[model samples]
Target: MKKFIKKIVLFLSPCFLILCLIVVADPFKVWFNYDDYNSAVTQNGEHVRFKLFNNNKDKYHFDSFIFGSSRSHAYKTQEWKKHLKDSASPFLFCASSEGIYGILNKLKYLDNLNNPIKNVLLVLDEHCMRGNSNKKGHLYISTPALSNESSLEFYKTFVVASLNV
Candidate 1:
């Protein structure tokens, strides 16, 4: 009986650890947060397209969006504001390895907003369509919601990925 219990504990250890990481890391920006995700862990926060949006979407009012891979990062919000001469701000949703999925998701998300999307600049490269599967895209900048998956499924996929790592 003791040996069986020991084996059970061993099997559960990794599961517990992964759960802790998910809660503490809070990549989805929905778990373990109180008043606000008002905070985040920087260890893996660099891939923050989702986090940045989640943490500040309600606060920032943007009429323009610059979407693409790393190339889009060069367009500062100020530059866009200056060029367009608009009162509404611009938000750049760029990452090192963004693809069609991420771009489409952000666009859809912006489209559903109450305010109108004034301008959109999408910069693409040969590698944008290099892959057929959305799951294979960059993990840091992707979200399940963009792919039409439910939030619960996203959490499940995240947990599974945690185990793989």
Candidate 2:
């Protein structure tokens, strides 16, 4: 019994040590900053998703909400703010390229809010509708309402972001 216990400890000790080393390295911790602030970490990886929307309700109430894969994140809020031209109407671009399932997850959580999201721009890459075997016909369906009205742009930013992620 003592020999068996010794073998188990010897096997697990290296793995445990490697895990400790990786945590101490903190590789992604420094890459979490944008807009001169480390808000991405504080927003996505740390705080609960719904909490973010709820906390900022006063600022985003009756505003336009942008949703999409990582493609949407590439848009600079300052540039979009000017495009919107309505200073009082605040907008947020909450985007992720984790696939359609990810976007749906975020939308489902945010949809619970009482805020009036006048426009939801679904900046999608072609892959958002195709190669999505992960969710089984879930996020690929066409919305006729948005199809006729939404502006379609093939931005280079989304491609770069997709590669980075």
Candidate 3:
């Protein structure tokens, strides 16, 4: 029995060590606080944008938003702001591959937060209308705060993704 238990421990030790490393290293940046997120690794733009808005909302007092997918990046915030009222504080709230579901959820999130939504520029195309569901993969997944998903499940998704390759 002692020998059998020793073998089991040896077999499981590497798995335990890997998990520990995953928690400590946080290759996906999901487990730790970061000042500037590294752009080399394709991150979930939805999550990153949401976190950025939440962190600086009070200071910026952003009341206007431009929501869309990567294509919308061409719409400069300065140009968009020119169309809005003088008091509008505009923010670019875009995602990597945004769909209608993401856009609606982001709108709902802002409404729930009691933030004023004075102006909105939605740069939409056929792609944005094609999907109304949450995207898969760590880089495309919706943020928990926007999707109302379990935070544990969100973190688990990132952890599992980091282990896949």
User: Candidate 3's residue-wise lDDT over 27-137, tens digit each?
Assistant: 766666676877566677777778778878999999999999988889998998888888889988988789999999999989998999988899999889975887878
Q: Which runs of model 1 end up more than 4 angstroms from their true locations?
A: 1-11, 25-47, 137-141, 150-165
lDDT for 118 (candidate 1): 83
lDDT per residue (tens digit) for residues 71-134 in model 1:
7777787877888855766777775566776677777776776656888878788876752345
Note the residue pairs that clash in candidate 3.
none
What is the TM-score (0 to 1) of candidate 2?
0.50
| TM-score versus the correct structure, for each prediction | 0.67, 0.50, 0.85
Instruction: Name the lDDT value of residue 16 in candidate 3.
Output: 88
Query: What does candidate 3 score in Cα RMSD to the true structure?
Result: 2.4
The order of the candidates by lDDT, greatest first, is 3, 1, 2
Candidate 3 residue-wise lDDT at 118: 89
Name the lDDT value of residue 160 in candidate 2.
26
Q: Candidate 1 — which pairs collide?
A: none
Task: Tell me, by lDDT, which candidate is best.
Answer: 3
TM-score, cand. 1 vs. native: 0.67
Model 2 alpha-carbon miss at residue 20, Å: 1.5
